[model samples]
Target: MHIGKPHEATTRICQASAETVEVRGRDLCRDLMGRLSFTEYFCLLLTGREPTDNQRCFLDLLLIAIAEHGMMPTVQAARMTLAADPDSLQGALAAGLLGCGPVLVGTSERCGKLLVEAQSRLAAGDDAKVVALQMLQDIRKTGGKLPGFGHPVHRPTDPRAERILELADARGVSGPHIAMARNFRAAAAEVWGKPLVMNVSMPIAAVLLDLDFPVATIKAVPLLARTGGLLAHLAEEQQNPIGFTMAAHAEAAVTYKNTDEGGG
Candidate 1:
């Protein structure tokens, strides 16, 4: 079945000439007088609220941090969707976003919520480090990895996390959320018995919480920013004469043994 046939058409937006500098029905553009940062555009689109200088800076840092990772699932999907000759750029982007679903690009917001939970446990007179440790242990008991701490591609420290933290501290972002990050870091260190820095999501989570965005909004904000790259890849892929084709492939398959089987 052609699952993504409609996505290509969805990305096509009407362009206006210099003589006709206005486009109607795109409310998000109303706030952009000119030369707005990606953060500003993202905030405008997601919240319909222009941010203060501080909020803008914070959001900008986050968006810049996760802006693109070449050949990631999202980008690959965008290229592949275009290869399929979808109807529009929007359709390619939609297909890309579908690939990003929960397994790939959906953890930033969950990490934000986890930071809040870690803080609440601290405020209730529990040691933040201990609380974080216990939480990690609980997740392990349930067969889950601790979120927001490690990444396959970014080891030791997520460079984006490092960059955003630098910006966040320079802007004087302080309070329990910051404290929670610090405490969580210590706990992760103890658990790993070595230094384990926060990944991109953690710093963004801290910054968003500091800016008073509900933790639930963290993932939404990043996803919104990501659509830009998604669209760009889609458009670029369209130039290929062959249209969208699988850019790469793997030939290996895994062997599995059933645990619930009787000798037959």
Candidate 2:
């Protein structure tokens, strides 16, 4: 049984032989291994082409920027999963990665799409500010949340986002996407009647788009980066387990009642 069309199937990503492996048209062991850093290798693998200096720099910078953030929910989930089953490290990591959604590592993908749509409207000759404001209005009309414009902890502006933008401008890579994100920041403040946090996800998407990264896999950035972070958390969990403690805290913080009576 097949779920989708199964026809002429092919893959240009990789192939292997008796003694050699090919990746993106390069010899894996010869041209790739030991020569390219993981960041460079990742870029090549993703785009099937070598990244320029700027692309490479930003990719590395972004990975470092988002790889770890204290004990985020994703980290907590992984740690908890590990505490429950100490032997299955992979399972614990999967538990964390599976939680990537609108509020987590997946936010960058939404932000990327948002920037791309704004760019499209700007391509139609509309003013950038007007395009941004109209898109903000549309999102508000649908009661949708803006993806990259707020954070629970990072107030006023996300330092990571600001750093990425500053680096993009210094490197001369801040293109229309970055501009659109900033425009949206301004429009959002006006539309929402107050300033909102311009979080890291906005600059992440903007820089990747400006660097011509693939839109469909923009989430891969955060997914891969957070995987590194989660692995670190899992390692620490083994030494000083706090997952169960976190679970206990969570249980104590919330009040529960039977649904037939009342719930909170």
What C-alpha lDDT values do all the predictions have?
0.70, 0.92
Instruction: Write candidate 2's Cα lDDT for 95-147 as tens digits.
Output: 99999888887999999999999888878899999999999999999999999
Clashing residue pairs found in predicted model 2 = none
Q: Per-candidate TM vs. native?
A: 0.75, 0.96
The alpha-carbon deviation from the true structure for residue 94 of candidate 2, after best TM-score superposition, in angstroms, is 0.2
Candidate 2 stretches with Cα past 4 Å from truth are 1-6, 259-264
Question: For each candidate, C-alpha RMSD in Å?
Answer: 8.0, 1.5
- CA lDDT for candidate 1: 0.70
Best by the TM-score measure: 2
